[model samples]
Target: MKKTLLFNILFYFVIISFLYSAGETSFNFLKISQGARQSGLGEAFTGVADDVNAIYWNPAGLAQLTRQQVCLLHSVWLVDVNYEYLAYAIPVIGVGTFGIYGTFLAGHITITDENPVTGQYIITDDIARASDINITLAYAKKLSEIVGDNSVFSDMYAGLNINITMENIYEDTGNGFGTNLGILYYPRYQNYSFGLMILNAGIASERPTLPFAIKLGFGYRFSFENILSPFTDEGYYKFSENDSALAIDLIYYPIEQTTKANFGAEKYWNLNKFHSVAVRLGYKFGSDLGLLAGLTVGAGYRLTLNENFQFDFDYAFVPYGDLGESHRISITGKMFGPAETNYFENKEEAVKYYKEGYELLYNKKYAEAILKFSESLKRYKNYAQAYMGMGACFLRLGKKETAKKVYELALQNDPNNQKLKEFIESTKWDIK
Candidate 1:
């Protein structure tokens, strides 16, 4: 019954899209790219919607979030125009994910009039403000909940965005309501993904139509561990995440009766568990602003501040022929670490660090051993071996009290561990 309802909704949505008015849509600013990471990726993020930016690109991606996130983006567009965007995504354990996406665009305009005496254009001393603002509320859920079994349909997700859009040009103002519907499929393995979205599919009071469009996207990622399994352990890299990703997006703008394609690639480098960097290149396949669509360059930096906080910064450089260049930057803060999301993969990496820490401890390098043990625990919180190693490092450094406390904490997590019990009993006076 639920599948029948879903099929009906999707069927009607596609039918209604072709019936909307074309070639005279207002509120065109709705089509502008909103996120830095996406803009750098040639605006092809519909498929790779893994972050808070997904609120705008494809709300269906929000269903994959294990924790909450907030993002702010700013861009200096061509001419005297600039825009700011903010996105927030929060997951509700059993229900679904909720998202808020907003956009504010401001442009400077000069008021002008024609003089009858000389038929000349003269600037008036009147204030002119050209502005646009859009706020959307979104919700997403995985299809598995309705199917009663996750084994087959776990990767399918659907979402909807309700929009409130307003525009102001001098003394004229218009307000409208619209919606975006999207679907995304991403398996647990995290190697590839696909997405479809229909944007701005509603009406306005004053304008005949909105900037309606359809987007289809696909993305793939290649990890070194998988490609170099001959030299790796269990096809998993021990140190960090190193991979290459590629994405392609096809966009059809009904208002203009035009179609375009975008291509993008990114190379990721993880220096360590705490820090990562990436380089991106993107291109659009068509004419843009009277010139051929050119290349776009971008870079990203991410730092894991601690177990509960992570920060990301991204920048994009885009060129527009005679119109000059546009620069975009964004900052995102996430509430959880990678371990909370990729459990098993992180566990594998954690064991490697624990082994290194054990070697350091055997060599009498207490401080270094402590650092490695801490890294291991960061990736897998309940790692009993890592906890024991840290405690031994403190004991060797003459911090008997600290070592006793660490051992006791380990016992709390692993009460059945005979070694931990024996260590606590032996260090009774130190613990007291």
Candidate 2:
């Protein structure tokens, strides 16, 4: 089935490339970015595509989603044009994730026509309307599920997007079809990802070819906790829960024969478990238009409605040099079903025990700390930090061999942790 799908995608691309080369393309609206979060990031979103907006950035990112999501975006462009986008995504149990999205760009213009016989210009109507609309259906699946536990294909995802587009300009109308192929790779136990996409592989019989392009990108996330231990040697631990991500994308436009590079960074602060605020900044380079069209900034807020529901709002500001500035806003909602249950009955209770364990360990109460860490693990079996605390308790109790074993278990749960690896190696001599 996979082979057949691959063949069909290639065949479609070949046919579309031929048709696109034979026709003159005119629908530039297809190249416009939609989601406010992505637009704020200089459209460098292919690698950080984690929300419903992934339908437009890289559909393969849908594989990372575990719940259903809906997103809406509205933007006011230069010359009074209005652009809007809507997207919804849902996961299908063991199969994969499916998404549907639509983008519309509309504007009003003055129209005039010349009389054939009199050779005189005549105004048929004072106002004329023009619009472009695109609708897409996409699917993404993890290759690990199909290929089994093979290391090479694990954490890899493939996706396909099919789009139908219509353009209307005064008396002229055009229709087209396009496809996007994308892949995303998330290494096991790592907070980074890589992505590649071939976008707008299609042609219109009556219009010019779509804005065909290829994009390659990567993203990395940094997480921080407990940053203020040195400020006050008090027993109280000050923790700042935050995450920051950096993303870069290189895009090649085939028709324009140009390449553009986009860079973006975002920092998120979690006020609590249920709310967060994010600041974003980005820059674009190698734009055919000019160098000044590179700066972008944006912000976002997320609110958790319940264990199963969340809402997100994002805004972006983009300047187009002399043309003007563009502002975009997007709202998204996510719903998690029963299948996506929380790991603990009460996360606060587990965290309390974990923190107590750490405090006991700091006070040199090894036996008591071991019991507290074990209790924490009973509430959250997959807590790697709790395992680390247990290992530390064992080390303080002079059970180096046991400590080495506990640390190794922690490494199993968090395979990509460099600090954990170093700690384990340092304890190797103690194991004997």
Candidate 3:
């Protein structure tokens, strides 16, 4: 069934869009970062573009999602202005992923007139109301799936976003359309990501300006407890999402001939399987805003509601020096269930210990790793990999005889595993 959809008409449609014209964009509101997390990172999310917010920073990140997600954000922007943002993402098992997000901002404009005699500006009775709305639809998929050749491009993802925008200033109202192209690459190295995006390249009959720009970004994760390990769970859930990461983005605006950079760091701590907390800090240099104004900080907490649902709350603060201060709040919801139900809950629990053991092994804590592997095996007698891992740990500890015995036991349970046979044959161990 999945293969049949691969050849569907939807797979053949390719949208490649880029615009490099030089001009001022009218819907400047579109340039504001959408989510609190992203904003706290100085909008450097082009690389670390995970979660539903990916729909705005780098749509290609949608390919990395394993389930359905939704997000809502509200920002008290500079100069007494405010905006609301909403985003949703859906991952289709066979057809790729789809996303939608919208940003809305409204404010009243104060009108003033200069008195000729006094040469002083006076507030007038007339005030103008202004508002802006931006909505985007996005799609993303692994390049291998789209091309039907996974051998080479398996780790490459591509995405596109269609932009719909409207701006109202006093009596002049305008509507515009645009496109964004993005790619996210996961190389052979783990926990490293590279991304690029070109966005908002279209024309408006009345506005005539688009915030056409490009972003090149990189992200790296630092992990110690298998947290945010970039590893998936049960082929359905996430197991290693507790970790810290650094992100950088080089942004270029063609119209303004300006280039800026964003640097950010974030850390996540998983209290258990059901709860997590995170903190973030960021700086944007070369922004017209002063150093103090370009600094941002944020924090978040996530609670797993159940097997299939999750919720997160986030807040961010930014000071714009004398201009004003900004405060933002965001809420995110996600739906993803483990592949196994109560019937295999034990097996799922076993995997947790197994991963902990593997990380211990990687960190050269052979004794600790053996204990964890033993705990995993206790949950499921037939888990061949746990037995194998235990054997490896014993070998690292120079207990060759015990290692051999464990390997033999694993082969007994998984008789057809050729890798185990080869592993045993290749090891040089003696049982005197």
Candidate 4:
């Protein structure tokens, strides 16, 4: 029975969509993109979608998320019009990621009525309001998890968004429903991805035609270290630290018979272990709306609260020619599973640093080697190999007291290891 009800709802929605496509359409508010990051990127986010905002840009991107997140955005538009959006996403282990989102666009206007016979005007209400509300539920799944490995579909992801919309303009009210479908492909190579989507494919009550459109997008991201080594220690560069990305999208409005192009770029700089910043710029072309609606600029900051929680804030500035400018602000919170370790807390990363330290020791770079071993211990305090490496580096630098202390700490983490016991015994004679 539930399936039947869902089918009926979809059938009616399609009929409404067809009826609206035959003539004209309404509900232009649905076309406005949400989230400060996306707006700053000229709405070219279909390919770069990777956050809770993906519920509006490209649902398939939700498959890439592994944690729970919530995002809120508020926009100060021209002429006192206000726009607000909120979204949340959660990942289900072995299944997929699910998300819900809502958007509101509203404004107040003066209402007046005239007596036709006397030609006199009477003020009905000074503060009448119009609003558009859209709520959506979305889901995304990675094909590799479902179809097994070594297949053509392994790199593909699919997602769907179902939305219900309500529009209130003074005394008139309209209701509608629609769906968005999207797919993403990540090639075996790193830093490249592609996405395609069909947007707003459904119908409305008062306005039959939905804002049907199609989008194709491409994105690439690479670390600065990939081209030039920034580490002065003559060691292997870290690939995950500093990065930049570029994305482009081609959008088509079938009903309006128009095509548009969007371009976006971003650079991320890590300030410390717990804080980072991003700068973004975007441009749009081939839009008939306004002459100055092309360029956008924005910035974002991220703070890690702990191993399990993080917070982000973003801002965007968009110009609309004679229509003035719009400012968008967004806040996001992310929470990870208790059992899962974050990037900085992973033992594998510590091991990598420990191995690098061993290499520096072989090259007889005592100070640089000590720094590498200390970095490893910062990530994993119980890393026995890193402690031993630190001890060896100190010994090479003729610091017998430091070497003895370090060896004792290593034995504490590996009390049963015979090699550590022998090393600690040998260090004891040096301390004497």
Winning model by lDDT? 4
Screening candidate 4 with a backbone cut-off below 3 angstroms (N, C-alpha, C), the clashing residue pairs are: 20-208, 20-209
Q: Cα lDDT of all candidates, in order?
A: 0.76, 0.77, 0.77, 0.77
Candidate 3 lDDT over 93-152, as tens digits, reads 889999999998876645666676676766666676667889999999978776664467
TM-scores of the candidates are 0.70, 0.71, 0.71, 0.70
lDDT for predicted candidate 2 compared with the true structure:
0.77
In candidate 2 the C-alpha lDDT for residue 372 amounts to 81
lDDT minimum window of 10 residues, candidate 1: 1-10
- Provide the lDDT at 107 for model 3: 69
Query: 39-143, model 4: which lDDT tens digit per residue?
Result: 778788888677888888999988888789899999986667788999999999898999999998777655555666676666554556667799999999989
* lDDT, candidate 1, 1-432, per-residue tens: 111112222222222232222336777777677778787888888887878878888999888787889999999865547789999989887899999989998765555566666767666665466678999999999888878644677678899999999987655688999999999987653467899999988898777778889999998766644556425321221223426778899989866888888888887788887898988889877644444335778999989777678888999997766656789999988896342332233788789999999999999998888878867865777777887888888888887776776677678779999967986896655544
- Candidate 3 lands at a TM-score of 0.71
Encode model 2's per-residue lDDT on 31-73: one tens digit a residue.
Answer: 6786888987888889878887888899998887889999999
Kindly state the number of residue pairs that clash in model 1: 0
Clashing pairs in 1: none
User: Model 3, poorest ten-residue lDDT window?
Assistant: 11-20
